[model samples]
Target: MGKRKRNERIGALIKILSHQPNTVFTLNYFSEAFEAAKSSISEDIVIAKKMLEELHLGTIETIAGAAGGVKYVPLVTPERAGFFLEKVCKKLEDPQRIMPGGFIYMTDIISSPSMVETMGEILASQFLNQEIDYVITMETKGIPIALMTAKALNVPLVIVRKNSKVTEGSTVSINYLSGSSNRIQTMSLSRRALKEGAKVLIVDDFMKAGGTAKGMMDLINEFKGEVQGIGVLIATREPEDKVVEHYTPLLYLEEVDVKNRRIIIAPNPKITTKI
Candidate 1:
């Protein structure tokens, strides 16, 4: 093929791989679709992979064998991730962010599409190798972040609603005590939403005592789904005994002194949550 034609083919390949991160596409599939030699397709992938890495866009992996091919994995570099988390912490420090009932007002940040997308990319990279079947989150505040994570992982997003909805058809509902409030609440999920024995990743905006995360684990069990991993945007400090033991929180709310209007937050040391 001509130089221009080859370039067009390479550009199109990148688009396909990027759009379907974590999904492997057999080299034969690309060669057949492009009507080009396998060798040419391999060369194009090499170029695309290099460009993606240099730009910090993402990385591509080449799988071998009959079922092997290439797959893209989205990621946010440690430096960029640290910068974004610090900025978020600074925003949280605003005294106005302190709301009634000792809660931090974070509706604006979690709802921001751009911010949530970046958070999702960072968190998704952590679970890329887990082989998750779906990204699960609660119906309300966690949906935006979860949706973006699902997009990056190329998986379906499943929502656990606070109550059973008539539009969801038959549902599996469970009642659990709220870890933070000690109040009993109900959470429901559509029975048809997930496949039996599927692996699910749980994502949430905030975690306090992990009542909701534990509840999610129970809900997933109803569908015979396994909880592969869990991720949270922020975790409160007082709840030292969180029901869910394993989770990667981007930031920890170490201290929230309502009287002094002081809020101390720190990044997760295990991961590059902050600088």
Candidate 2:
């Protein structure tokens, strides 16, 4: 590869490393892909690490022993996360996003893959050590984020359905009020989906009245599973009593000025200590 092309490859690799910390790669892996020597790749890695640390993005950790490799660890400082969310909140600016019931409609944010992945990564970073066995979400919309979080944590996912399935031999069912509507709804789980004492994290696309969230908690309790934590993509902040006390939200929409096409969202509130 020419000098310019080699430098570009190095830069692209650095960007990939930024997101995948703790992932190790062999020198042969890069050497074969870039047609570069191990010595040159090592130098590139050193320079990239310096650039990353100087920019305060993350740290490049290098292991030098027999199984040595490189890894990037992103320490999303408080300022960084807050700033990122602030910009993300601006994307929700739509006059039609405001519902008649004084709620900010944020289905768009939940449906966007980039937004959902970012929210999942941020939440997963916070629970790096809670020994999360699997991620749990109520069926439908929450599936994407729940699946993303599960992938980030390298765990399985279990979706609670509103109805039973004929394919599953037996099922566990629990009743809880749906968040959108105050009426009670049944959530079902397959008999083999989760095991007792498994630490499960509950995540949803949005949090309004939180009835669905509470119902999820009840279903989890029924399965003999432990609720590790709860999280949501967007939350309505006017009435603090609307959602559970011990939960995390990626964005807090305090107000939605439909007439002005303005929607305000603040940084997600982090849980000081897991519940």
Candidate 3:
């Protein structure tokens, strides 16, 4: 291949780094790929890093030592997070979303690719420094955001099933009280899903009383994994206290009045103010 121009090199560098967030690409590797000198690649990295940081897209980091390389860390600025979350709150406030049982329908929001990808980036940013080994979530609803979080962190995603699957081989099951329904529920995980002492972040679609989040925590404990953090798309304000404490919720669902066809929700003050 012929020598690549500066702008061309920088563009390609950003594309590769951002595509695999948190994955390190060696300078030598770029040098070989672009048919450029290590010095030229290093300069390209500096330019890419500056542009990304200035635009609040993400950050490119250089690692030192033999194992070190350049990596991209996808981060959402607090301002950006607050703005996006506020928009979601507005969408959720539509009274039409209220269900018969006083629940707000949010399947479309959580399942949206663009929305969840942004949500995942925000959640992943909060725990980026924690060196998370995996992102965990319950089956079905939470999978999309959790998978995106895992993708942003460049880590694996562990899904806890409502029941053990024979295909998963031996399993570890746990029973916990459901905070929302006030009933005992069972959740199981594949024995080989997580390694002992792994650090994990729990991502969920919603938290009413945190019953499901707590259940996931208990399931994590079964494997001796540490719960570094918990993130949920929305949490109920009435609960005040939850089965699991110390969680980050992007939005607070204050009320869902079925009879009046009213829904009240807002971005978490903690998130907006912190930004």
Measured by TM-score, the strongest candidate is 3
Which 10 successive residues of model 2 have the least lDDT summed? 266-275
Q: In model 1, where do residues sit more than 4 Å from their true spots? A: 1-6, 32-35, 273-275
lDDT tens digits by residue: candidate 2, 78-180: 5556666766777675566778766666677777887776667667767766878889998888888887777666678788888999887688998887656
Candidate number with the higher TM-score (1 or 2): 1
Candidate no. 3 TM-score: 0.96
Which residue pairs come into collision in candidate 2?
Answer: none
lDDT of 1: 0.89
Q: Score each candidate by Cα lDDT.
A: 0.89, 0.75, 0.89
Question: What number of clashing residue pairs does each candidate have, in the order they appear?
Answer: 0, 0, 0
Q: What's each prediction's TM-score? A: 0.91, 0.73, 0.96
Candidate 1 residue-wise lDDT, 101-163, digit = tens: 778899999999999998899889788778899999997999999999999999999999998
Pairs that clash in candidate 1: none
Order the candidates by TM-score, highest first — what do you get? Answer: 3, 1, 2
Which prediction has more favorable lDDT, 2 or 3? 3
